[model samples]
Target: MSTSRMPLALRALRTLLWILAVFGAVGLALGLVGLAVMTEEEVVRETGVGRSASMAALLPGFALVLVEAYLAATLIRGGRARRWCVRVLAVLTLLSGLLGLLFLDVAGLFEVAVAVLLLALHESRSAREWYRSGTETGKPDGAVPAPTG
Candidate 1:
């Protein structure tokens, strides 16, 4: 990705991804703390799930959240592959969010919204051409090239 004249979609996606990562991490931490504070019997009585089971359930989410953070970090550098990375990650996020819904997680809605926005932004014409141009010039499609000496 060109540092200069980066597409608004990319900029927004990158920022949003990082924000999602932060929120996910915070949520996970809170969940863990809540679990830790609860007695095993209380956990079973309250949620019909054991503490260990709940901890196990959180592992995949933590992994995926880390991946989201990684994707955001990747966007900070120059690469042709970042566009495809964003697309694939966005789909994963959407599916993950849908899976979260099955567990009655309200946070899933935020995940879905961000994923949908990421899809729309990255799929925009300007963003596509920006990736396609593959030049450091930072001009997306047909902008006039600087006259070389």
Candidate 2:
């Protein structure tokens, strides 16, 4: 949180998350539109894809925006909820990537990969700084220090 110790990548990731959330919302709206306006037969014929499969594919991104919103909210609150939110997002991103890969959809996979990589980078860098400060200076950032004999 210190201005001096801030990493550029973390800022960039935060910006990316905002952009991603907007796109995710759009994707969600499009999926809802497809569901409302198109028949199953028309969807399959127009996209060469099944309606069920298309909806399934879009659902994760839509759900992730909600997840990301939760994370953003809880992250600011700073408690167990924040930790859980980060872990959930990480796991979801990995799972989304894997699912896309299994379906042979590179676009979906790429979106997931970008999300995961940015989050992973931010977390790892933050953890590294935490570890260094704890080991070298005998203090942790934001977290309660363990009792030592």
Candidate 3:
């Protein structure tokens, strides 16, 4: 079975993922700029670390942004790899969100909500079917059908 059109939920999820990708990219660029403009003294004072250590401390954030960008690309392209990536991302998001909530951080709670939504989207029947079939064929289930006479 195939869908003639992308389900509304899937479309919305894809759009959200793309938006997240853009957000991550912007954050990464801003972070790089901030790091570049900060004085060594300021970095040391803020992080209580030497210049090199402070730069190294930024690695996790950079990695997260890179993962977000990759997730967006995989989601947009749609394949077996996307299924695994989404699962991993969802788990990471959930763990981060839970940790945030434990520390009484509002942002963590928000992240938790987003993680739940992402999980829901991924586990939806349509999404599951689509992934199963689409990955096998290396084409989305919602591909436009060729018109027949």
List TM-scores for all candidates, in order: 0.75, 0.61, 0.74
- Could you arrange the candidates by lDDT from highest to lowest? 1, 3, 2
Q: Mark the regions of model 2 whose C-alpha exceeds 4 Å error after superposition.
A: 1-7, 44-61, 127-149
C-alpha RMSD values across all candidates:
5.3, 7.4, 3.8
Tell me which of candidates 1 and 3 scores higher on TM-score.
Answer: 1
The candidate with the higher lDDT, 2 or 3, is 3
lDDT of each residue in 1-149, candidate 1, tens digit only = 24346677777877888988898899999999999999999988977899999899999879878887987776644366776777888898899789898899997898799789989987888777766666355444456767779
Q: How much RMSD separates candidate 2 from the native structure? A: 7.4
As for TM-score, the candidate ahead, 2 or 3, is: 3
lDDT by residue (20-46, candidate 3, tens digit) is 667767876776677778998887777
lDDT of 2 by residue, 18-131 (tens): 766777798799777977699988988887888888778776666789777655433322334454566667677777778888899887677677757766755776644633
lDDT of 3 at 26: 83
Q: Which regions in candidate 3 have their CA more than 4 angstroms from the true location?
A: 1-4, 135-149
Clashes of 2: 0
Which of 1 and 2 is ahead in TM-score? 1
Model 1 RMSD vs true structure: 5.3
